[model samples]
Target: MQQRAAITLALASLLAIGLSGCGASEAVETSPTSTSGQGSTTYPLTIDNCGTQTVVTAPPQRVVSLDQDSTEILLSLGLADHLVGTASWTDPVLDSLAAANSGVPRLSDNAPSYEVVLGTDPDFVTASFGRHFAQGGVASRERFAETGIGSYLSPTDCDNGISINGGGTRTHALTIDALYEEITELGAIFDVPDRAATLIDGLKTRAAAATEGVDFAGATVAFWFADTKTPYMAGGLSAAGLLAKTVDLDNVFSSSPEDWPATTWEAVADRDPHVLVLGDLQRDRFPGDRLDDKISFLESDPLTQTIDAVRNKRYIVLHGAELNPSIRFVDGLEKIQSWLREHKDEL
Candidate 1:
């Protein structure tokens, strides 16, 4: 707790120094339009983000995205040209964004050192998870602020008690609203509100279409992110929970508050989920990070082989990014919905 307080104090001090002479910039009133005639974002735009006041003097020209989700969000906004560096990928880039992502320099497949990140000379930085800003990951948001670099952390991770060693817990269930807010805020920061709006609308429309008439009232499911021995199961307040709730599927481990809680195979078998949603991560950080490994373990293990999901091979594979709160979360929802449609009769 003392460490956390010190970090907070440092952040406040740095923010104060950064904003020493800057009073609130004039607010520009414009119609909330998503296209032309939408007035440009006024300079010295100040955003109260995750309890930190982020001041953007101008649209970030050289930005460093510290996570895959944030990188994808920027790419979707047509701001790929503004990206100076990107890092921490869990899966392959989305097919549609591959061309643009290929152009951005990859700092690392995981978190890059603070100095390495600074070497890119980025005017702004962004991350989808709070862990990336923790001490051991890259650098604290305060550190970036001290260097005159504006930063944004996804609202989904805000106040979630995240640390370098854990994924954190969520007291309330996550929805697409947080993700939408991130996109909209990033748009405002980049002076591309229209792109953000269009992206949000499209996502909402897709989510609506996916959930239309879809009801799986009593069906039970489990999301396994990684770790073969003590599987990390999704709790109720995560992106996985959002997908389950969207289609009315009950998450077997929904009672847990931790975003990803490690559970014994015996415990998982006790619930005996009707379906298993496995994360197909490209990163090999853990034993079960790969799809084949997860499947092989489920089918071969004595404790899990008898489980209903394993017995029936009712498995749904999702990219690692899809399991996290981001634009691809909508993709995960659609895929799960599609799977249910195909197997509803079995249920």
Candidate 2:
């Protein structure tokens, strides 16, 4: 499963406040903002840090997006007018995400420096990558405040500072509920509470629809990512777990102690799942001839042929974005719905 720490507006009940400094409440606005729309509720949003509140009279006008996924959400919400810039630490914008990305200032070739962030005169800086904070000096919470720029961490990237056994790190330790929570939070923060509620409700409905009549007590599957020479395993509480629940399939990797831990082929052989979710392949990572040389390696891996998922062809190849938990998460549920329907006969 994919996760983000790109600090897209974070929405958690923080146990310990980060470096966000305090801003005294402004003299009360004689007339508080009316947040209602046709009987809908309006909340007086207080963007705070450590018990203090910062209210904006209108929607943000100068937003600097630090993570691509967060940028995607802003675009999805039709909030590009607020964008002053966008940046990413990983690959550049995929074609689907390019329309919104064009012409916007690039903060960095790979994560623009805080000075660059300041230069944009951004009102809001979106990012939650732990490295941005945990490994300080690059762009600490202090930097955002010093520049009068508000910083938002991705609430989904909750791994705050937790470490995993494998090489890679995981986020907020992962939970389906967390995914829904993030969407709802984004909705409220962006003043599109209705859309957030609608999207989340649709996901729950679709996931339930996919698993309605099936049983999975006897079946064991792998939330498999057969890429990068090793088998990446997804733990329960991850997007894959949510995916498994959607289809009433058991993910053999459900027992992983850490979320999204790297499991070896030997481990896969030991559990030998009946199904495989294999999207994050090398071919998928590269669009054209960029990574073609590794095609033979992927095909020749011993795990390729011996896994039951391969022989029985119970593999599920998902779109790259599907693996991540975001508003796009609903898109993932849709894909799963279609895939399960296409293979419902097997179940």
| Clash number by candidate, in order | 0, 11
Q: What does candidate 1's lDDT look like per residue over 1-347, in tens digits? A: 00011112112221221111100111122233232223456545667666666666667778999999999888887777788999999999988788878899999999888999999998889988888777577887888877888788888786444431224556678767778778778877777665666677677777777788788886899999999978999988888888888888889999987778899998999999998999999999889999999999998898899999999999989998999888887788778778877988887
What number of backbone clashes does candidate 2 have, counting pairs of residues 3 or more apart or in separate chains? 11
lDDT on C-alpha atoms for all candidate structures: 0.78, 0.54
Estimate, for each residue in 1-347, the C-alpha lDDT of model 2 and write its tens digit. 01112222234442111222111111111122223322222333444422223443334568887766577666544456668988753334545446656767777645677777778777766653444544443475555565565555565555543312212355433666755655455555556544545545555665555455555445677765445555467787666666676567787877664556666778877787876665443234332212232234434677656767656766566644456555455555666666666775674
Report model 2's TM-score to 2 decimal places: 0.68
Regions more than 4 Å wrong, model 2 = 1-44, 47-58, 89-110, 128-131, 136-138, 159-175, 201-218, 281-298, 345-347
Best by lDDT, which number?
A: 1
Give Cα distance to truth, residue 74, candidate 1, Å.
0.3
Best by TM-score: 1
